[model samples]
Target chain A: MTALLSLAIDITLLSVILAMLLCMIRLLLGPTAQDRVLALDTLWMCAMLLALALGLRFASIIYFEAAMLIALTGFVSTVALTKFLMRGEVIE
Target chain B: MTPELDTLPVWVSLPVTLLLLLGSAIVLIGALGLVKLPHFFQRIHGPAITITLGTGAILVASMIYFSALQSRLVIHEVLITAFIMLTAPVVAMLIMRTAVYRDLRARERGKTPPAVKDGEASEVYPFSTKKSLSAKK
Candidate 1:
């Protein structure tokens, strides 16, 4: 990677972290479940992006796999939470 | 432990840098909307930008960076993109439906909504605090 690209990745990482902090604020301050759920969804999206950005920064392939794992697990958890929100139960 | 990062020509690095910056900025804007928007219905639309455009841009950047750096096709980013594209809408839709249903039920309960302050609406969330509820009754 070039110097410019490295610097850009750093800035990108900063912005993603800032975004995560914003999501955390919403998650902690939620007065409703949906808001918190919405915040959590956005939070994981930021996490996945963080992983991808990290992969680029370090020139490693492992972070891509980590991003994939975050996406998969985040999706499952969000679905379960949404199901509970909809009907007060995930299994029923 | 950092991998040995060799040089990429300007042609490759420049666009990757732009895409990365663009993706992050968009993600930041989306998160801001989530926090700034007053209502849940309005706020829910915010992350759509992050999930789709922001993710797409970064993944494309990643694809280009990796391919150019390795001198071959490295396209695993595609799988993540596909999974996110397939799942984002479902999650958004289900969450929206739950919100609409919950709001309706709250309306039907015929009790005045708990007073909202600082843009927080008091809806019955599974994770809601109960001490306040007992006092309200």
Candidate 2:
């Protein structure tokens, strides 16, 4: 809410977005499937952090819930992808 | 003007700003490592820092900010911290295991794995080499 906190939040937001772009580069340029999956996992984390920074900037709690959702779904999807890689299918 | 400096005392904002900057800087560094590291194993290590330290700092900042502003505990961010702590290593382990297995399978089939060579189980490709790392011939 103070000026310094506000500026820090803005910086956090921009850096998070940059992190996501770096993840995208890995996602596209990854030499292997696991690399892509790893990139996606990091991407999800950046998004959640972005959401957190946004919530702080706006002084709202709703963004935290959205971050929680992203974290939950991202965990599931990454596990599923890894499973598929390991056994060629998500379920037997 | 709508009071540009609305009411977070320096006591709270100082720590929050420091933590926010720390979190974002670490996040950026981790992502940079992910992109810059040439090998899959090294790349896998990059986001470990992000998942752990970077996210932890940000969540702690959030907790402090919200709790201070609302004058209550407001600690639900801890749930996210716990979930990530429990799950991130598992995900990383699974991915690394899968990569190792795939490489072993390729070796068994007498084909060249992209990031390994010489049929030596321990011989993962080093990042300093200029050889192709693509999953192709």
Candidate 3:
């Protein structure tokens, strides 16, 4: 039973990590600014998913808290980018 | 523990695991689309797919598994889900604005957006403004 559970956890973790790696490729190869920003957005979602997986694997709430923080930071960055794009600057 | 997982039945873990895997796969495919999509406009939609469906799946899995394990109603997963739903669109909006800005500037300069906005001011993303045109010049 323990072995099966571990396998499940490992597979989940591997798949999430693989997704993160693919997003990283877009981050590196993006031919345009929008593409890179889009990739960054995906990257944040991937990281959050990873955190949830960790929480499940360890049976800890701390990972979830960390995930929340990551989500917040990602939000702020995206907003800043949008504002900068619209106004020609992110801040005054 | 969120004060809820203690009573979660063991049976819930299997399906939750499956959902998470499925979500991760979707995210992977979205990234691939981001890489392979031809233009900035098409690329914008790719990650949106991940942010919506992909994140939704993982969040559902979290809610289910945690609720089952902790033996209580865990509602905090909703918070993250809400956060992602709110932010992904905003980020995409910014990227689109940047693309549009580049397009307009390109038309002005008599060159394709690729040549004019490649590292120019008009291409500045709506977020940092600091990383845009002035730096390139």
Q: Can you write out model 1's per-residue Cα lDDT over B14-85, one digit (the tens) per residue?
A: 899899989989999999999988777778888999999999999999999899878999999999999999
Q: Between candidates 1 and 2, which one is better according to TM-score? A: 2
Rank all candidate structures by their TM-score, best first, as comma-separated numbers. 2, 1, 3
Q: What is the DockQ of each candidate?
A: 0.65, 0.71, 0.47
| Residue-wise C-alpha lDDT for candidate 2, range B1-137, written one tens digit per residue | 12433766888889999999999999999999999986788788889999999999999999998998888899999999999999998998999989877766675577766655424424454332213333433
Rank order by lDDT, top first? 2, 1, 3
Give TM per candidate: 0.87, 0.89, 0.79
Off by over 4 Å in 3: A1-5, B1-10, B115-137
In angstroms, give how far residue A37 of model 3 lies from its true place.
Answer: 1.4
For model 2, the DockQ equals: 0.71
Q: Which candidate is the best by DockQ?
A: 2
Write one digit per residue (lDDT tens) for candidate 3, span B2-112: 334434445775677677667767777787787776667667677787889888887888788767666679879899988787777767766776777766565556665
User: Considering DockQ, where higher is better, how would the candidates rank from best to worst?
Assistant: 2, 1, 3
Q: Candidate 2 versus the native: TM-score?
A: 0.89
- Candidate 1 regions exceeding 4 Å error are B1-6, B112-137
- The C-alpha stretches of model 2 lying farther than 4 A from their native spots are B1-5, B117-137
lDDT of 1: 0.86
TM-score of candidate 1 to 2 decimals = 0.87
Error of 3 at B136 (Å): 26
